[model samples]
Target chain A: MFAFYTIYKGYFRTALIVQFQYRVAMLIWLLGGIIEPLMYLVVWRTVSEQQGGSVGGFDTNDFVVYFIAVMLVSHATFTWIMWEYIYRIRMGLFSVMLLKPIHPIHSDIADNIGYKFLTLTVMAPVTLLLAWFFDASWRPAPWTLAAFVPVLILAFLMRFYWEWSLAMVAFWTMRIDAMNQAYIVVGLFFSGRLAPLSLFPEIVQRAADILPFRWMLSFPVELLLGRITPRELLIGIGAQLFWLLAGYLFMQLIYRAGIKRYAAFGA
Target chain B: MYYFRLFATYVRVGILGELEYRANFWINIIQSALDLCVALGGIAVVFSHTDTLGGWRQEELLALIGVYFLIGGLIRTLIRPSMIQFMEDVRQGTLDFKLTKPADSQVLVSIQRIEIWRLVDVLISLPVLGIAFLRLGASLGPIESAVFAVTLLSGALIIYSFWLMLSTCAFWFVKVENIQVIFMSMWPAGRWPVNIYPTWLRAVLTFLVPVAFATTVPASAVSGRITGATLIGTVALAAAMLLVSRWFWRVGIRFYSGASA
Candidate 1:
């Protein structure tokens, strides 16, 4: 474990330096991460205020806290591997990753961690500004706050493995852009970025509950905001573990299939 | 006549190039469907909570969404793909080919590429816009139609200039493509009326990224929400942005060629 830790430390340090060098790209990327949640934040808040101060169990202030927490949690668990894979496969860069002794995901995981570290400097301050701007209201239970740590880590791993498995589709078709877009659209809906799950229809909420999407992102935010009850928290953790395991198995299957194809086609 | 002939030739060539990639057409259709699901579905979800948001009715908001997709389609079809190519040429040091053309470099770069399949989005959005109008029972007078056309033209020109200015920065900054993400990130904001946002965000949408002019302004014209002052301001801003971007492009080319050195 320590050896694994040291290897990732090296990757993180190098990635941190490279990310720092392109400081403007870093900032541009952060804008995309924050703006979606912020836009939804404004829209939902407006709807709540217009509907006599609250709608569907969340007032304007409650939404303010919900979206701010969402911004942070989404940023933490986000993975760009799907898009990166398309580019890498197009450019014949995946061959280089395959040549490495260690699994390519370890490096990707390290880079993800490194990027989160850099962006949090900006995201943290932005969150504060959003909290101020929206008059966000929340008082977390200390126990729920403690549970947030494991849940967030699980969320990140679940999303990463799932997206990484999706990335392996690059080996089958170089043109996975459409598929990736479809995934993102579904992810956006099921992840509760469109609205809090409570705001959706019973059918939509049930589908979101059964799927891995909510557990990967929105569930962590729900946990952090104390929106999850004790029983629901246990169920949420079970869902996260289930998805994480499923994602791990999916990644193994897809990577094997992808490797076989790459070996045959030599791209 | 020369410009017309040149553009006709480009259309033929672009169509030929697109024909070879038949898969892209299917992909375009699928992606467009998914986009509609998310966009109109979100509107449905929002309206489920309230009747009117920020004083705009549901039909008006649909018109706004139609404008978003229409302008967005146009950009993807002609403007964005061409500019992305121009940026790539800059990175690959092949922009000299564009410079060597008899026509102006900006004009050449702007008309260089077209993903004709992206017109699918425009075709799809037209019906949505029509549905919105039908729902509103909007009767179009000749003057209202003219105002809508004028606003849309000005909006397109404004967006083109803003994007050109942004792509022009490529001569100095090699990775200006990342900067394009700023426009994409802010685009969904235009799905709703800009007035819904805080004053600070409204200013950002209006002035910084120009989404207000490109989408909401034209959509407002269509929905009979545009004021005389807003229409005049859009035209004036479009004209000013064009001139400024043209000037900036010249400066960029000079820098690229080391003429300043």
Candidate 2:
């Protein structure tokens, strides 16, 4: 455990320095992340206006809060591992990664968290500015606010593990863009990034619950906004735990199998 | 006339080069289809909540989306790929070879690379536009079609110029590739009616990135929603931008020192 801790410290430090050096590149990437939710917020707000200031159960203010919460939560949990793995395999970088004594997943997790820690300084202010600009209003219970911390941590880990597992597809085929895109499209609908899952059709909402995407992204956002009921919160957390464990085991299984099949093509 | 022939030669070469990778055609189709789904699905979700979005009927927004892909495909197929290549060349100090060529460097760089498979987006957009026109029952008179053709030409020019200017910054900044992400992020805003956005954002989409000219103004022309002033303004802007970007390219070329030297 102590050795693992030291290894993570080194990895995290390297990630922080590397990412900070590329902070300009990092901020430019954030433009897309920020705009997606902002565009949806504006569109939905426009819809609510044309519908006489409310659509379904969400008022304009509620829509604003919901999407702002989405921005924060998505920034917290999103991963680029699926794409990174393909690039790594193609460049033969995975060979070096495999030679390391530690599991490659630990370095990825450390890198992701390090980058997020740096970007959160920018994202937090931007989110607050957006909320203020839009005049967002939401009142979560103190308990839900407290619960958000643990739920968010679980959401991040679950999403990371699942995406890491999805990245394992790189071992089987280098043509992973289509597969990654398909997963993204499915997740966009089910994870409530495109819109609130509640706003989706009943069938879609049901499917979202059955899929892991909801548990990965939207569940925490909903909880933070006081949108989820107490009973639903219990169920949501339970599902997150289930997906988290499943993702870890699936990632382990795939990594072991993929390493066996892996060949150092460019190396 | 010489430049036009040169452009044709580049197009032919680009097409033949891409034909080597035939399987990418299917992959392109799948990616385009998925992108279309996301766009159309977003429209479906929005319209599911309300009949009209900021006075844009479902079919009108569909038309807007059709233009989005049509223009977006053109960029990806020609302008974006070429500019991205230009940037990579700058980073690797390989741009010196292109500069030493006899032709105008800007023209050469702008038309050099093409991913022809991205035309799948263009093909997908045609059926979408047809369906939108069919549902709206809008017959295109000669005037409207002429206006559309003109505006479409101008929009493409404007976008090409914008990309050239953006890419030219690579002469000074070695890592300006990510700057393209800024335009890409703003590009999707065109998937919606620009007027529906807040005033400041609309200004940014119009005067700043000029994505409004690329997608919205042309869609407006076809939909019969365009004012005469917007039409005149768009053409004027396109002409002005071409000159400005040309001047900027010259300036950038002069500043560029070959790294190999």
Give the number of the best model, judged by TM-score.
Answer: 2
The candidate 2 chain A region of ten consecutive residues with least summed lDDT is: A131-140
In order, candidate lDDTs are 0.88, 0.90
lDDT of 1 by residue, A115-140 (tens): 99998899989999988887776899
**Superposed Cα deviation of residue B256, candidate 1 (Å):** 4.4
**Per-residue C-alpha lDDT of model 2 across residues A1-267, encoded as one tens digit per residue:** 999999999999999999999888898898888888899999999999889999878889988988898888889899999999999998999999989988899999999999999999899899888877888877889999998999999999999999999999999998888889999998999999888888899999999999999887888888887888889999999999999999999999998999999999797
Off by over 4 Å in 1: A264-267, B172-175, B254-261
- DockQ for each candidate? 0.78, 0.80
Over B1-261, each residue of candidate 1 has an lDDT whose tens digit, in order, gives: 888788888888999999999999999999998998888988899999999988888988888888888999989999999999998988888888768789878888998999999988998899998998788775555677788899999999999999999999999987688867889888878888899899999999999999999888887887677899999999999999999999999999888963222
Off by over 4 Å in 2: none
Q: What TM-score would you report for chain A in candidate 2? A: 0.97
Worst 10 residues of 2 chain B by lDDT: B136-145
Model 2, B88-205: lDDT tens per residue? 9999999999999999999899989988899999999999988987886755667877888889889999999999999999999877898788999889889999988888888999
Best by DockQ: 2
